[model samples]
Target: MSQITSPPRKARQAPVPAAGPDDGARARRVSRLKRRLTPYGFLTPTGILLVILMVTPIIMVITYSLLDGVITNKNPAFIGFENYAEVLTDPVFFKAVRNTLVFTLTSVVVHFGIGLGFALMLNSPLLGDRIKGLFRVIYILPWLFTVAIVAVLWRLLLSPNGVINYLLGATGLTEGQTEWLANPSTALAAVTFINIWSGYPFFMISLLAGLQGIPRELYEAARVDGAGAWAQFRHVTLPQLRPIIISMALLDFIWTTQQFALIWMTTGGGPIDATEVLSTFTYKLAFTRYDFSVASASAVLVLLMSMVLAFFYVRHQKSRD
Candidate 1:
């Protein structure tokens, strides 16, 4: 009876194997790999887009610049730098360059002056906050309008018998209906003024922020040192704002040089190319005249010019940092 034989002794069971070091190591390696690849995975889409949109087009345009009869010829012939030489020697190109210089320099200078003046006024301790806020709203109104709207609005204002013309007539500021945008003599000036009006707000906002960030202790010390308002502004405010001013001016120069939409919409680079900048010159070459190769060359030249500005800007930023 004890003879159940201990219920047929239970069979020895094999102990379950513990996880090995190799398996744990493998899991850690997988996790590390995932961490390393996550950022690249996120950037993959953006990298593809940049290559497709920017890099591809740049390469194509450079290639086009070196060839002749691109887009119009099935098998374009290589012309080397001939297109560049032609573009460089072209009188129209020089005219465009001159116009671009005038437009950019005038806009940048006037923009800075006007912006700095407004920023100083707004930052004045004498001005009430409510008054400053109202002025800010009014000053920023120009920047609120789209470039297209600005172009259209100014076109209407500068048109013959428009409100501006009516006022000028009433005031006897001019003789007959002066075509502000159509007359070669006035077209460039008119476009430059429009650009200045539309762009100054950007400088104003940036300078205002910079002004607010300036340490008040500096001003107090200047005052304690018997420095008058002009001296304090010259020594303290100007120096404090120099970095912002330089950076803003450089950026404005680059942007203004590339300005096409405003000029195109306002004057179409018309009145015998009076307002023609490089951008319009290139546009007319490519689309209007169907000279893609020459246009590509012009575009490449402009890109090089922009690159020079960008190099200086980058160097300045690095020095600041």
Candidate 2:
């Protein structure tokens, strides 16, 4: 056997197989699936939070609005749009709407004017950087304060025996102490002024950034074309800032209409409802009168109004993009 063994029969070895097209294709498909799922995996947490916090509350509020005495009544009966009808017909609601419009419009206009003026000053080449920096600090001081702080500060200042009264008396602007916050004739104006003071800095900062972004070449070209200062501002400056102005105005409109903290802390919509706004109206209905159903209806109406503004805002932003 040792002599005639055919060089020791080699053991048969199984052939190694080549990779198939199906294997490669399956790998590519797995890779593609991973890429697509990664983003969704990241967004899942945020989506869950939004659903829990925002969507859930909105649905609850809407449901409450359709019922009668939702929280107060043990068995809330579905009343369809009756609450809405009541809210729409109430004289106080109408008054609140009017006041809201007036307050919001006035604050937005004044905020724009003040913000533009400050932004212009800040952007002026005539001023030194140091001066600009100092002014910026001063201008932004109002915005640095929280709503609670601003409310308290303004209340003290506008009090009958406060510094403002003393100054008015000293300057002979008024002979006696004026009850600014307590008087019906002045309460609305007082709160409005306070709101303007606090809000203008937001517009100012935005406008200043916008002003800086305006190309100097445009102004130079305007000058070469014999455009005066006012003309240049009307054409070049206004045109350049138009987008920012519109965006800011719409945002301010939305924010001011929803203002509650400052109004609540400062005036509580008091002085015979002179300063009553939609937010305050809804709040009074819910907490003051314990009318949750009506308050929910009013809140839904406010949400609709805000949605309209938001729609325009989104459209404008898309156009710009």
Candidate 3:
């Protein structure tokens, strides 16, 4: 009876609840940790791919640059810096380098200029949204085409009897049918023009995004300060878009320097090497001349220049952050 009474007399107690400030804090800590790790977790696959694909190829190229003979020899000999020295002294390499620099600088200047103008037009509040959308689609259309396709299209147009020359003659812009891509003096310039046309769309898209991202308050503030269109563009727009411009310029320069398909398909580094760039030269060294070692060396040099630009870009991005 006593035992039964004791068991019955045990007081009822409420169940302990789980949700509290400490639980919330622990959950929040877990959330923060997940947030911190999420990006890296996502990036891991890409990082692995880059190392396997991009980094491995680069290392292979560097090793090849230091070695002599890839296909012709059974046991490839190590040439050390001899390839570098020879490549550095080669007049063809110099000419190619000069042409590449010229092409990159000229094309980038025109690209930025035209792209900036187009972006400003697109960003104008005077344009309705439908019109803006239409024009934007049109602007990006050229970029959708493959480089090889554009090269083929432009090759046809730049031929002596092609549509472009016909139009030029029809418009009285030229005296006669001219071999635009055949003439040594004009081949590089002609190719340059084609690239500019094909490339400006990319610049336009980038700058347009930059323009759209700009706070309208800045524009209003500028207006309050009695700033006109040009003034507002110079002080407000340019400053905000400076980083984009610089980054785009660096990327464009690197790309233009290494551009191959369009150039090879169009000019083939011909007209007495008038349109020769580092990339074309490298290809010719490897395939045409069957000199893989020299080609690798040249490729290494190009990679070095790209690395320098990439370094600057990384620094710029970090500083911006």
lDDT of 3: 0.92
Off by over 4 Å in 1: 1-37
C-alpha lDDT of residue 31 in model 1: 100
In model 1, pairs of residues that clash are none
Would you estimate the TM-scores of all the predictions? 0.91, 0.94, 0.85
lDDT of 2 by residue, 220-301 (tens): 9999999999999999999999999999999999999999999999989988999999999999999989999999999999
List the global CA lDDT of all models: 0.96, 0.96, 0.92
**How many residue pairs clash in model 3?**
0
Give the TM-score (vs. native) of candidate 2: 0.94
lDDT of 1 by residue, 1-321 (tens): 364544577889999999999999999999999999999999999999999999999999999999999989999999999999989999999999999999999999999999999999999989999999999999999999999999999999999978999999999998778899999999999999999999999999999999999998999999999999999999999999999999999999999999999999999998899999999999999999999999999999999999999999999999988
Distance from true location, Cα of 304 in model 2, Å? 0.7
Ranking by TM-score: 2, 1, 3
> Which residue pairs overlap in candidate 2's backbone?
none
Query: In terms of TM-score, which candidate is strongest?
Result: 2
